[model samples]
Target chain A: MTYCVGIEVDEGLVFAADTRTNASLDDVRVYRKLHVFEYPGQAVFAVMSAGNLATTQLALARIQRDVDDAAPRNLRTFRHLFEVAEYIGQVLVSSQVDTAGRPEFEGISTQATLILGGQVAGERPGMYMVYPLGNAIASSPETPYLQVGESKYGKPILDRIIRADTRLEDAARTALVSLDSTIRSNLSVGMPIDLALIRRDDLRITERMRLDADTPLYSDIHANWSRKLTEAVHTLPRFPWELPQD
Target chain B: MTYCVGIEVDEGLVFAADTRTNASLDDVRVYRKLHVFEYPGQAVFAVMSAGNLATTQLALARIQRDVDDAAPRNLRTFRHLFEVAEYIGQVLVSSQVDTAGRPEFEGISTQATLILGGQVAGERPGMYMVYPLGNAIASSPETPYLQVGESKYGKPILDRIIRADTRLEDAARTALVSLDSTIRSNLSVGMPIDLALIRRDDLRITERMRLDADTPLYSDIHANWSRKLTEAVHTLPRFPWELPQD
Candidate 1:
């Protein structure tokens, strides 16, 4: 399982994902689920994946192959961010179909979903969640964020904190906090985490860092968030019964 | 869908449940999920339900009928709280089996899971999560809470705040907060929550309250919690980039 989140705010896009992947208890492995495609000042794309490891790898390989072959249609050829998302969705569907058609993979699911966040020159920065079935939907100004995999444990915080007008740095911090909450509650989503930031209209990845549990910034955030949350609960208005029998 | 939580602490027990049930989007109804069987000074049980509404209704009806008929075994006849849990689990499984075996109920799930929390005189107070399979597990001191239905959204807070030594009033407050989180994140779990608290060795419910969205205590807690959380996030350590880049 993986936990990946992408947030689009007024200042930029924030992408965060946990690196743990496991086929079983004894087969856990760390695999970077955050994939980035950059063409310098032309465009930048951060694609975060969850589900079927092989399917995501194959879809990504096909996208890279298209870029290398200068295919008629590819990530580099897209005019809008949604176009790239659509192409990625198609690749995801094709990969799942090809895998499912194999006799050896009959009962296995080859589905993978992705969050595409970035910008093309002269266009607004955006984020889209591409479905395994070859369709995509953009994040709305109201919601302003997209998530895939082990999402529920981390969702209440996002639903409360994220908005289109939020600052880019605050969104990034919120994403990290959300990931930390999930990693604490669920063992499947572990660190090191991959984080990427793309400032609006920059057409370049701004800050991309890999943070492990021991990394200073990630550790501080985790410890402080936990302490603050505990404090928050303690400070909640006491029950009427707890207030003196007035 | 429902959201119900039972917390057992050294001080006693806390049970909270939302009051919304639906067969379809257009068929929504408010149905209390918390049922109390109190033989005051003898024993008391608070049963919280989630899953097929009809199955739960039938199971509760059977339990009530047995008590009224002075059955050989009933809530009033249990020696230990675990025995009551076992009786409830058997009732739940039999209800599901009977409903599922009916021809008209084919292709539909008749499952219902429950949390039974209470005490019989001379025994320690406890809580059990009874599964649809007629097996049950007690809430331990290490993990002193049991949740059913749409549980994930409300879990992080409980995981952070609950402990074996938490005061019963604080535990009740925590349960309400947990329910509030689930209600905010899930449409299936909603207002007019039913709450019950049993103080250890009392052998009777110490407090029972039905709180709605408009209830003053509930509303105040909601507003204050939201405000405090926002404040908590603002106070989280700033990212290095946002710290003037020194």
Candidate 2:
């Protein structure tokens, strides 16, 4: 199980993914779910995956292999972000099908999902959520955020706070807080997290950071959010049913 | 779809449920999901249902009918809260299985879950989550809360703040906050809430309230939790993602 969230805001896009993976409670392990394919100042694409680890890894590797092979058809050579998204979708489905034929995937849910977001030269930054069936949907202004895997526990905060015009830094802050809420509630979403930022029209990666359980900023925010939420609840007027006691 | 939460704290117990019912998006309607069975000062039970509304309603009706039959076997005749829970579990499953045999339910999931918690004449206050399989589990000191249906969106704050020793009033407040989160994140879980309280060893309902969408207290807490959460995010230190300047 995992949790990954991507936000497309006015300042840019924020991506965060938790690293923990588990076959079951007793077979927990850590694996980086975030993959960055970048050409520094030219273009950068980040993909966060959830589902069968082998299928996702193979999909990522296949995409990379296509790019490295100087193949006539590949995401790196795509004319636009949408085309890149299409290429990713096509490659993911093929890889998943190929991997499912192997013994490792028996009885496992082989379906996978990926959040593909980044900037490419000469295009507005774009974000797409690619489904396991090789279809994708781009985030629009009305829904400026996309979440994959263990999404529900962290979604209320995102729905209430995230907007397209939010500053990149603020979006990143919000994404981390969202991650904090999910991690606290679900053992399957355990961290070390991978976070990335992209500036609109920059066509390059701006900032990428890793946060673990001991990270000072994350620790502070987690503790403070809990305390503040409790305080907020305390400040609400007592429900009339219990007013006599109060 | 639904969201209901139950809490057992040192002071007593709190149970709350949203009223929304829908077979699908277009078929949405609101119906009371909380049922109270009371014998004045002798005993009181609050049951909140989630999943197939028909099954839940039938189960509640069956229990009530049995109690009214003046038979030796009924909720009113139960000697303990666990017995009441067992009775509910059996009735809910029988209703679900009965409904599943009908043509209308052929393609639907036969899932139903209930939260039964309150006091009986001779026992301490108790809370149990009754499963569709005629099995149940009681809340304990280590885990004093149980939630059913569309529960994840509202779970984080509860995970962080709720404890067995929390005051009943505080627990009620926390339950509302949790429900508010779910309502925001899930369209299926909407307004018109039913909330009931039982004081420790009181063997009776201490307070019960219904909260509609227009209720000032409900609206205020919904707005305030959102505002407080946004403010809380703002105060968190920005991610040190060193992006290029605008």
Candidate 3:
């Protein structure tokens, strides 16, 4: 289980994801789920994945190989952001097809889902949710975000905070808060968190970093958000009995 | 497709549940999920359910019939709250057994889960989560609450707010906040909400009310929570670049 979110605000795009992976409780491993492909002035793409780690690694490896070989249909060959999303969606499906239903892998779900976002040199930055089945949906003005894996626990924060006009830093903080909510509510999701920011029209990745539980900035965000949320709950209109008498 | 929470605080117990049921998206209906059984001066029990409606109704009917007939092991006969929870768990399993695996209902799950809480004559107030498998677990100091169905989206608030010593009304409000979060995040869970409060040693439910979206207190809670939560998000510490320069 994983939790990853991608937000496409007017300022740019924000991507955040947890870094815990486990085949079982005793077989836990820390693996980076966010992969960035920076083409400097050409294009920059950030892909965050959830589900079978092997499958996601397989898909990522294939994409990297495609770029290395300059395949007829490669990540770098795409002219539009959605085309890149479509190409990655295909890669995800093929990765699962390679192992799912094999006699030895019968019970395991090889399926993987991804949030792919970036901007090409001539196009505007956008984001997409790429399904394990190879279909994709782009984020729009009405819905400025996309998420994959263990999404529900973290969604309310995103629903409340992210907007098309939200500042890039605000959107990034919102994404981190969303990820933190999920990590607290679910055991499968844990830190360190990987975050990437792509500034609109930069045609390059602007910021990419990993945030651990002890990281000063992330720790501040976590502690401050919890305190503020608890204060918010306490500040709610009290029940008739709890109110002070006039 | 339901969300119900049973909380045990020092003041007493709080049980809250949503009122939406559906066979599918297009076949939605509203049905009460919280049921109270009060034995004034003796014991008071509240049972909230999620999962197969028919199975829950069947189990409920059986419990009622057992009490009506004054059977050897009726709800009134239980000496401990756990025993009552156990009795209900068995009833839930029997309810499913009565119709599950039948030819016509091939893919449908007849399983249902329940949260039962109350105080017996001489024992302390307590709560239990009755599983579909007929096993039960009691709420403990570490976790003074139990939830069933679409529980994740609503869980963060419960985790942050509810405690063994929390005031009963505060617990009740927290449950509502939790439910509201779920309703916003999940289509399977919705309003109007049912809330029941049992004051310690009352030997009966102290108060019971159904809250719709338009109900005054509920409406206030909904509006205030949204505004306060957004405020909380904005109050988070700003990033370096977001800070005002000297």
**Top candidate, metric DockQ:** 2
**Can you tell me which runs of candidate 3 are displaced by over 4 Å?**
A68-77, A93-104, A240-246, B99-104, B240-246
- Model 2 C-alpha lDDT per residue in residues A1-246, reported as the tens digit of each score: 899999999888889999999999899999999898887667789999999898899999988888899888876687688988899998888877544556776676777999999888877888999999999999999999999988988887787778777778878888888898888778899889899898887667788889987898888877777777777778888777546863
Per-residue lDDT of B1-246 in model 2, one digit per residue for the tens? Answer: 899999999889998999899988999998988888878778888898888777777888898889889767788788888888888888888888554567877778767899998888777888999998989999998889999988898888787778777778888888998898898778999988888888887777888889887788888887766677677777777655443567
- How would you order the candidates by TM-score, starting with the best? 1, 3, 2
Residue B191 lDDT in candidate 3: 94
User: Candidates' DockQ values?
Assistant: 0.55, 0.63, 0.54
Q: Note the residue pairs that clash in candidate 1.
A: none
Instruction: Provide the lowest-lDDT 10-residue window in model 1 chain A.
Output: A232-241
Runs with alpha carbons beyond 4 Å of true place in candidate 2: A73-79, A98-110, A185-187, A241-246, B93-111, B201-203, B240-246
Docking class of 2: medium
In Å, residue B79's CA in model 3 sits off its true spot by: 3.7
Write model 3 residue lDDT over B1-246, tens digit each, in one string: 999999999899999999999999999999999999989999999999999999999999999999999999998998998889888988888898555558897787888999999999999999999999999999998999999999888887787777777888878888888888889888989899999999999999998989899987788877777667766666667766566999
Better of 1 and 2 by TM-score: 1
Q: Between candidates 2 and 3, which one is better according to lDDT?
A: 3
Report the error of model 1 at residue A190, Å. Answer: 2.1
Clashes of each: 0, 0, 0
